[model samples]
Target: MQILIVGGGTGGTILGNSLARRLANEIRAGKVRITLLSASDKHMYQPGLLYVAFGQMTPDQLYRDEASLLESSIDFHVDPVTEFHLDRNEVKTGSGKTYAYDLLVIATGARIVPQEVPGMAEGSENFYTEEGALRLHKRLMEFRGGTVAMVVSLPHKCPVAPIEAMFLLHDFFKARNIRDKVKLQYNYPVNHVHATANVARWAKPEFDKAGIEYETLFNVREVDPVKKIVYSEEGTECKYDLLIAIPPHRGMEMVETNNLGLGGWIPTDRFKLTMNDHDNVYVIGDATNIPVSKTGSAAHFEAEVASDNIVSVIKTGVPVREYDGRVYCFIEAGFDRATHNAFDYINLPELKPPTKSVHWFKVAYNQMYWSTVRGLL
Candidate 1:
C-alpha cells in the first residue's frame, strides 16, 4: 500500500513522523510506503512570527529543514502540487511527477491573499510570513510614533495574534517612552474581539488597562494608501500611520482547481475528518471548512485522530478515531506575561489569566514543538 501526504507543515510533519513510527514493521516488510510532499524544504514555526515582528526572535530560530525532521523510512518530495485527480487517486506536481496512492491525506494548509482587498497589498504590513514579519520589524524600528491600526481580514490563522500584536505594540512604544505619541487600535470583522465570547469578556479589561482601542464588525472594504485610511463596508473609516493587516485566507489552489469545495476549502466531516464523498481520503488543518480556529494546536489534535484512523483502516478496514475540533492558544500580553485558552466546538474556552510563568511556557513551547516533530516529545 502507498500513502501520499501533501504538505510538510505542522500537521503533515507530525502525521508523517507518527505514522512512520507506528508502521515501522510494515515499512520494513515492504507492505506500506509513505511519502510526504511539500513545496518548500523550510518548515517554519508559524507561532513565532509575531515575536519576529517585535524583534524578540530571529527567523533562523523558527525554521528547520523539512526533510531533517522526518524519519528515514518516509520519502520526502520538495515540490509543489499542481493538480489533484481524486477520481484517479493521483496527484500531479509542478515538476511533472505523478504519484498514485491508495490513501491520500490533504493537509495543504491556507494561504493569505492581500490582493483580495484593493490597495491592501501596497498599503499594509503583515506578520504571517517570515519576510512579512522581518519587513514589519524594520518598519516598526523606523517608526517615530503615530497611529498603528491592526486589522483582521477574517478566517485567518491564530485568532489571538492580532490581539497579541496590539498588546506588544503597546509595550514596545512604552519602552521607548513614546507611548503617548503612538495610538494602538485593533479592528476585526466579527462582532466580538475573539471567537470565544467569554475570552473576549475577560480580555476587555486588559484592553482597557492597556489603553488599546477595540472595534468589532469592522469589515474591510478598501484601503487608501495615499490617505492612510481604511474604509469599512459598514460606513466607518480608520486612519493610520502604519497599517498591520491580516489578509483574507483561503485553502490551497489545488482544492479550487480540482473543484473539491467552495472557496477552495475541502468539506470534511467535522468529527471524522474525512472528505465528503471520499472515505479513503482525509482532510485536516486549515484546508478543511470547519468552524474551529485555524491554529497549529487544532492541526496537532487532528493529526492524532487522522493517523489512528488511517492505521485502523489499513489494518482492519475500519476507522475508530474521531476528531474533537479542539483549539489551544497562548496569548502574549506584553510585559513578559501570557495567558492561555482551551476550548472545543461545544464549550466556551477556559482561560488562564496572564502570568509571567505562562509567558515562559510559550517560549518553551517553541522548542518543544521541534521535539514533537521529531517524535521525541
Candidate 2:
C-alpha cells in the first residue's frame, strides 16, 4: 500500500519515523511506500517554548533538521502542502507535485490563532508566536517590576505552559533579587486551576508559597496596551506592568478544507485511531478531537494504536488497537522542581507533590524527544 502523510510537525514526523521503521519489511517487499511532506527546513520542539520565554532555553536548542532523521526508506518532501485531494487520495504540495496513496494519515497538528481574539495578534503581548516570544522576553528583562500578570486565554496548546510561566516568572524575578518589586498573578478560565483536580492539588499550595495571586473563571476580553491594563467580560479590570498571555489554540485549516474530520477535527474511535469518517484515513495528535490532554504523550500513545491498526488492516482489513485516552503533563515550576499528573482512568491515583524526582524525569525527556526523532522510540 502507498501511504502518504502530511505536515512534518510533532505528529507527522514522529509518526513517519515510527511507521517507516515498523514497516521496513513491507517497504523492502514493495508492499508499502511511505513519505513525509513538510513546509519548512526546521522542525521546532514546541513544548520548549515555555523555557524559551523565561530565558531558560535558547532558540538554537529547539530546532532540528527534518530531513536528517526521516529514514532514507521514506521520501521527504520539504515543500508546503497547498491542498489535500481527499477524494482522489492525493496531496498537492506548494511545488505543484501530486502524490497518490492508498492509506493516508493526517498528523498536521493544530496551529494557534491569536488573531481569533480580535486584538491579541495586533501585538500587545503573547506567548503563541515567535515575534510574541521575543517581545515577551524583552518585557521580562526590562521589568523594573510591578504587577506581572500571566493569563491563559482559553484552551491552548500544552495547557500547563501558562501556569509554568507564572511560577517561572516568579523565579526569574527572584533570581534578579527584585522579587518584592512586583506582585505576580495567574488568571485563567479554569476555576483557579485546570479541568482536573490533580494539578490543582499541587498548584494551589505552590501559589500560596510563592505569594502569587490567582484568578479563576476570569475570561479576558482585550488588552489596553496604552493603559497597561486587561479588561474582562465580567467588568473586571487588571492593571499590569507586563502582560503574558496564552493565546487561543486552533485546528489546522486542512482538516476543514478537505472535509475529512469532525467539525474541525478528526473523530477517531476511542480504541483505534481509525477515522469514523473513512476507514482508510487515520488521524492523531492534537488534530484529532480526542478526549485527552493534547500533549506529546497522547500523540505517542495514539501512534502506537494507529500503527497496530494499520498493520492489521494490511493483513486482513481488520482494525486493531484502542486508545486509552491516556495523557500526562509534567508542569515545570522552576528552581529545579516540577510535577506531572495522569488522568482519564476509572480509578484516581494519588499525585505526589511536584518534586525533585519530577526534575530528573524532565531532564531525561529531552533525550526521549531526540530518540523519537531517530526512530528509537
Candidate 3:
C-alpha cells in the first residue's frame, strides 16, 4: 500500500510519525511507502509566536527544521501542492510530481489573508505573517502611549489568539512602565470569551485585573487606517492609535479549484477524518471547519485518530479509532499565570480546573513540543 500525507504541519508531522511507528514491520517489508509533503522547511511552534513578538521568546526559541523533524523512515518531499486530483486518488505538487495513495491525509492548516480585510492592504502590519510579526514587534516597542486594540476579523484561525495578544501587550507595557498610558482592548465578534461558559466566567476576572477591555459580539467590517477607527457591525465605533488585527483565514485555493466544499471544507467524518465521498481521502486539523478550537492541540488529537484509522485502512480497508473531538489548549494570562482549557466538540470548555501547578508546568510543557518533533524526525 502507498500512503501520502499532505501538508507537513502539526497534524501532518505527528501523523507521519505515529503511522510509521505503528507499521514498522510493514514498512520494512516494503508493503507500504510513507511520504511526507511540506511546502516549507521551517516548522514553527506558532503558539509561541505571541510571546515572541513581545520578546518573551526569541525566534530561535520557536523553530524546528522540517527535514530534521520527520523520522528518517519517512520519505520527505519539499514541494508545494498545486492541486488535488481526487479522481485519480493523487496529489500533484508544484514541481510536476504526483503521489498515488491508498490513503491520503490533508493537514493543510488555514492561511491568513490580511488582504481580505479592507484597508489592511493599505499596509498595516499583521501578526500572522512572518514580516508582520517582526513589524508588529518593532511597532510595540515604539508605542509609548495611546489605545491599542487587538481585534480579530471574522473566521480566524485561533479564536483566542487576539486575546492572548492583548495580555501579552499588557505585559510589554507594564515592563516599559507605560501600562498606565496604554489602553488595551480585545475586540471580537464571538459571544463568549472561549467556547465554554465556564472559561469565559473565569476569564472576566483576569480581564478586570489586567484592565484589558473586552468587546463581544462586534464584527469588524473594515479597518480604517486613515482614521484609526474600528467600526462595529452595529454602526458603533472605537478609535485606536495602534491596532493588532487578526484577519480572516481561509482554506487553500485547491479546495475551491477541485470542487470539494462540503460545508466549506472537504467533507469528512468527525472522528476518522476520512472523506465521506472518497475512501482514499482523509483530512484533519484546520482544513476542515471542525467544531473545535483551530489550535495545535486539536491537530494533535486528530493526528492520533487519523493515524490509527489510516493504519486500520491499510490492513483492513476500514478505520479503527473514532475521533472524540477532544482538545486541550494552554491559555496564558499575564505574568506566570496560565490555564489549561479542554473542550469537547460540543463547543463547551470543560468546567473542571486543572492543577494550579499548571504555571510551573509551562516550563516543562515546552519540551513536549520538541520531543514530538524529535520523535517524528
Per-model lDDT: 0.90, 0.76, 0.77
Model number with the top lDDT: 1
Which pairs clash in the backbone of model 2? 271-322, 271-323
Better of 1 and 2 by TM-score: 1
Residues 36-58 of candidate 2: C-alpha lDDT, one tens digit per residue: 88878788777766666777677
Task: For candidate 3, write residues 3-29 as lDDT tens digits.
Answer: 888888899999888888888989999
Scored by TM-score, the top model is 1
Q: Per-residue lDDT tens digits of candidate 1, residues 1-377?
A: 99999999989999999899988999999999999999999999998889999999999999899989999999999988898898999999999999999989999999998999999999999998899999999999999988999888977988888888888999998988989998888898888886568878878889999999989899898999999999998899999999999899988878888898887789999999989999878888999998888888999999989999888887888888788778888989995999998888777887768999999998999889999777777
The TM-score between candidate 2 and the true structure equals 0.93
RMSD of each: 1.1, 2.0, 2.3
Better of 1 and 2 by lDDT: 1
Report the C-alpha displacement of residue 339, candidate 3, in angstroms. 0.7
Candidate 2 local accuracy as lDDT?
0.76
Instruction: State the RMSD for candidate 2.
Output: 2.0
How many residue pairs clash (N, CA or C atoms closer than 3 angstroms) in each of the candidate models, in the order given?
A: 0, 2, 6
